[model samples]
Target chain A: MGLSIPVGMAEVKASKTADDSLSALGLGSCIGVCVYDPRARVAGLAHVMLPDSAVIRATDRVVEGKFADTAVPALVQRVESLGARRADLRAAIAGGAQVFSFATSSPALAIGSRNAEAVVAALKTAGIPLLAQDCGGTVGRTVTLDVASGLVRVRVVGGEPVDLYRLG
Target chain B: MRDAGRPGATGSLSGDAGTGTRGILFMAFEAEGITELQLDALREVGNIGAGHAATALADLLGEEIDITVPTAGLRRTEEIAASPEAAEAMVVGVLFIVEGDAGGVIVYVFSEADARFLSDRLMGLEPGTTQQIDEMGCSMLGEVGNILSGSFVTALAEFTHLDFGLSPPNVAVDTLATILSEITVTAEALGELSLELDTHFVQQSGQLEGRFYYLMDRDSLGAILGALGMAG
Candidate 1:
């Protein structure tokens, strides 16, 4: 019932305002990592596009939230910066769909499952507990995180938003 | 390669008109890094490439088809996903991986309604009869997109004298933002700057329409521009 600040690709956003909601729309082969601190009422979301930043290290375009290895840690840090304790943060993720079900050697086409795995591995490396995840399918999704209640939701195209997980 | 990631360099030439062809006012390609002269050369390439593509599409549909003036630019994954038309729109995308002289990805996008309509007609069924897309429909659409991509490839090959090999077409129906994100991100992750050249294919009856998107890597861009004598 409040403001919906949409998280964008390769971008990480955190909000301390209880009424604010964060969402990443139409995520295909891109993972939306949602981290929340229930006690502090802070929430953050990162729309990650690739598994590793090392692949694009040669380019100056390797932004923070563009890859799983970077996004998970960055999202945690952003929430911590917003009065949330690192240990208090918990995570839930959605998206990372194999949008095109094709047999190709390109890493991009098969990136969805790898993204899910990478995000999970990154969260583990950061010591953040992954409470729930809905990832890796043939359809794209929209992931939303409600800051006030720490509720996360997922919606496919032309479908209603359904509650996936709640952190508290 | 030098101009690939320079922000604020795009939208200089297109302005509010946005590539100036569709008349729909969607910012299909707010290009980056290329000079006006080089962009003109790229436009020439699109014109010839899409001309052949349109003919193939027309033949496939058994109807007259018109091709819009193509738009050329350098696009990042984030920018492509944030566009107004792509935000939440559902689309059918057919992808072809390009190899050989230049390597990258080319995708043809159609709105869900357009996909259904065209696929139904292609399958010799009533246009409105199909409620959901099936494997048969996807295969039909894939072949159609493959033929059109082949035509465009032939034109590009002739223009640059470069050999191109295409992988089998892969298809998906999803939100435009997601599909586009997957593509541009792939190029970025591979450390290639994505050069986008896109055009609209419109049938006279307006019953079928689609967008053809060609995203080449930095190597391809340089090679094609050099071949055309437009490289700086």
Candidate 2:
């Protein structure tokens, strides 16, 4: 088995360590942002929990990857610092499922949808193309990005791991 | 039934407080950092709330129900970000919105097997018959969750003499980490951390069935603390 690094909530993992696979597990409403530079074979993964960081940033703790707005930009920079070209970066995302889908009035049910929207908008602002995505449903998902092969995979509970995206 | 005293039954919950955890740090949107005394107050809250809930459930079923001593987890957002709770563990839960003087979220969680067991028991079906919780199964879970969570809130209100309201419960089945992470961010908005007051329910044969996670926002924390005269 290859080295699989688990990306926890509000954390980003990126480097030229191409053999390592970065994974975000049990993503409920939280989103897993994966950015890859096929040319450099370098990839970065971020697990963002919230839509934006404007309010979180004003707090006593500033987690760069806690929100989509911050995590996207931060992932881009971290991947680039690993010798990946900014222009060649391609992004793919997964997670952000409305697991608590019943109550339409509750704001908790909206976070998943809001996070997906914020991540797409952030990628657009950063001039990164969101080549693929699997988001927004009633089930939780686990996303993994294999840096060496640049293949992204997603798995739901009681299900097999399926290829979300394959980048040769 | 370990009749360990309330608050003292929690061995490691507040044991870490007097350690180096005390610093200039504070929960977001709240004025004070968590201290040993404040944690004791929160534990007592869990104790009283769970105590009342246990009695209510026992009365409803007309049977014996035992509650494990309540335990509290004051997890830092950073620690949660490092390694979430019960990674890959799935749970059937009902999320409730806390309203009135103190507001936050409370999640009533149970294992899939436990939920299935309870659902079977509720519907008077034979054990080991439920493959998956269908509409009826889910409804049973919801109603029971509603009753259990409602009892807890009533206890809090009575203890603190504050008015409280509960929203209609939203039931879900998902990974524990995912559910907890979502609650962490959603319940408090940008909260640096929220306390989780966990208590388990034991019924016939002393088997554990369900547990409750009591999460509070900054204001909720302050309100309870203030009511207890532990506000700092």
Candidate 3:
């Protein structure tokens, strides 16, 4: 099923076989932070909307998949549910735009930036090396993760699509 | 001094309090840290956000949705700090984290019933489920928050020729007090502004409640307005 998932959302759709994991489109200023472990053939994606869970109310259910701090852990846990290991898993990050009106603040500290930093921090804290990153800037991005092939695509307007796995 | 629009036939909740020439105009004092221009920028930015949100809603629900342009209203922390409704209000807060070029989050809140109304329609569920609240329901709710908030932030970038980084939206279901407290404590970090918009759904009772908090110093707002060629 070719489905388009909007921002601040994630879906774990699977195909009949181990080769049919799903993919989501466009992630900008929003992170398309994904995790995959070859051994488990498992992959997970989160379109995070904030940096940390601290900003949310304790009773909110949407908190799990909403922030980078929490969502990253949740994605890792999800992949692990299918038998993926943190040590063997490779991570990729993309998209975070300063989507609001102009300001003098450093874009590096904006929510998008914070999310990227938080994701990186969370992965490192979990002892996982971030294999690749496509973060920052002023554009919206669409990300696709083909769980079966372990192929990931990051697309943005005015630029060529990029392969997150192959990038140095 | 007040210029009230013709009051809608539907009586105000206060009934007796809204009959004057000025309808119901609740003006919170100008935000000490927020400037008029920033509020305007936020308003225009909201239009863009709402437009994108409308499109997403149309796509998700397979129906036509229209959102009226946003109007800016700067309310004091005290004014909005109070719960507007007596019943337990189901509010979803979408915080668009902006970094690199800008900083802040757009806090969009809606009544739980309204959220379910939009969620049911978006998920293609039948009517009468508008009052249902669950995790599945929250996912749909998160989508609307993400689209509307993200688009609104994106509009700011377009108008100011600035780039922004965004964090994912923080979705929650809570009471007005809880939601207000969540925003209140962050007062030091944000230049808050409120924009209450009127949104229309194809076959559902319309929804209301929208607000934005730009985490920037007061001066930055003037600069943004100057960029838009508007007065501070």
- Candidate number with greatest DockQ: 1
The stretch of ten residues in a row with the least summed lDDT in candidate 3 chain B is B14-23
What is candidate 3's CA lDDT for residue A32? 76
- Candidate 2 vs candidate 3: the lDDT winner is 2
Candidates by DockQ, descending order = 1, 2, 3
* Model 1: colliding residue pairs: none
User: If you score just chain A, what TM-score does every candidate get?
Assistant: 0.95, 0.94, 0.80
Residue B222's lDDT within candidate 2 is 77
Cα lDDT tens digits, model 1, B65-166, are: 766533556766566654755568878889888887877787888888888888778878876987777778788889988999898888889988888988
What is the DockQ for all candidates, taken in turn? 0.56, 0.53, 0.02
- The reply for model 2, stretches above 4 Å from the true place, is A104-108, B1-32, B69-71, B78-86, B190-193, B204-206
Residues A1-62 of candidate 2 have per-residue lDDT tens digits of 67889888889989667679999987888899999999999989999888877765354567
- Measured by TM-score, the strongest candidate is 1
> What is candidate 2's fraction of native contacts?
0.59
TM-score of each: 0.88, 0.87, 0.44
Residue range B1-232, candidate 2, lDDT tens digits:
1222333333322211122111111112122466766755665676567666776666665566666544456655545431345667777878887788888777777778877887777777898888887777777888887888888898899889888988887888877777666667666552444666656676756544677677776667778888889888
**How big a share of the true inter-chain contacts is recovered in candidate 1?**
0.64
Docking outcome class, model 3: incorrect
Candidate 2: lDDT of B81? 34
